[model samples]
Target: MAKITYIEFTGEEHVLDLEIGTSIMQGAVDNSVQGITADCGGACSCATCHVYVEPEWLNKLGDKSEMEEILLEEVCQPQANSRLSCQLKVSADLDGMIVRLPESQF
Candidate 1:
């Protein structure tokens, strides 16, 4: 299983021990961590699950798909590391990954 770590700006951290095959959004919603709305459910149609993935871990994840890239452009605060969590899947290499939640979603 790959473990993903989520860190809020407030310093709160949630460590999700997810099955290697599940989507990052699914893990967050299943774990009930705040900041992940996943309104579109893992379809990559909504930007509510926007997250800033630490640069160090970016290479670990594959390139962003066209659909996820376009949706990320609509996020309120798009950073160089901004990514739609729904598009990322849990993997053994993603253990200890830290993602920051955006300030606004709606």
Candidate 2:
């Protein structure tokens, strides 16, 4: 399992030990973390699970897919580090990874 930290816009933090292969979005939704809405689940069809991966961890994640890139373009506060949580799968390499939620998902 990988330990991931999700920080809300308000500075609230939720740290979870997610099993390998689980998406970051799944960890938040399953644990009732407040920032990620995940309206479309892990389908990558919605931007509700948008997050900003901490700069130090950016190189550890995979490149965003075409669908993810398009969806991110429509989310609030898109940044160079912006990512769709559902597009990120957990793994040993991601242990201690930190992601910051946007002020709004809509």
Using lDDT as the measure, which candidate wins? 2
After superposition on all CA atoms, what RMSD does each candidate show versus the true structure?
0.9, 0.6
- Candidate 2 Cα deviation (angstroms), residue 75: 0.5
Clashing pairs in 2: none
Query: Model 1: which residue pairs collide?
Result: none
Clash number for each model: 0, 0
Per-residue C-alpha lDDT of model 2 across residues 2-96, encoded as one tens digit per residue: 99999999999998999999999999999999889999989999899999999999999888899999999999889999999999999999999
lDDT per model vs. reference:
0.88, 0.95
State the TM-score for model 2.
0.98
Model 2 stretches with alpha carbons more than 4 Å out: none
- Model 2 alpha-carbon miss at residue 55, Å: 0.6
Candidate 1 has its poorest 10 consecutive residues by lDDT at 2-11
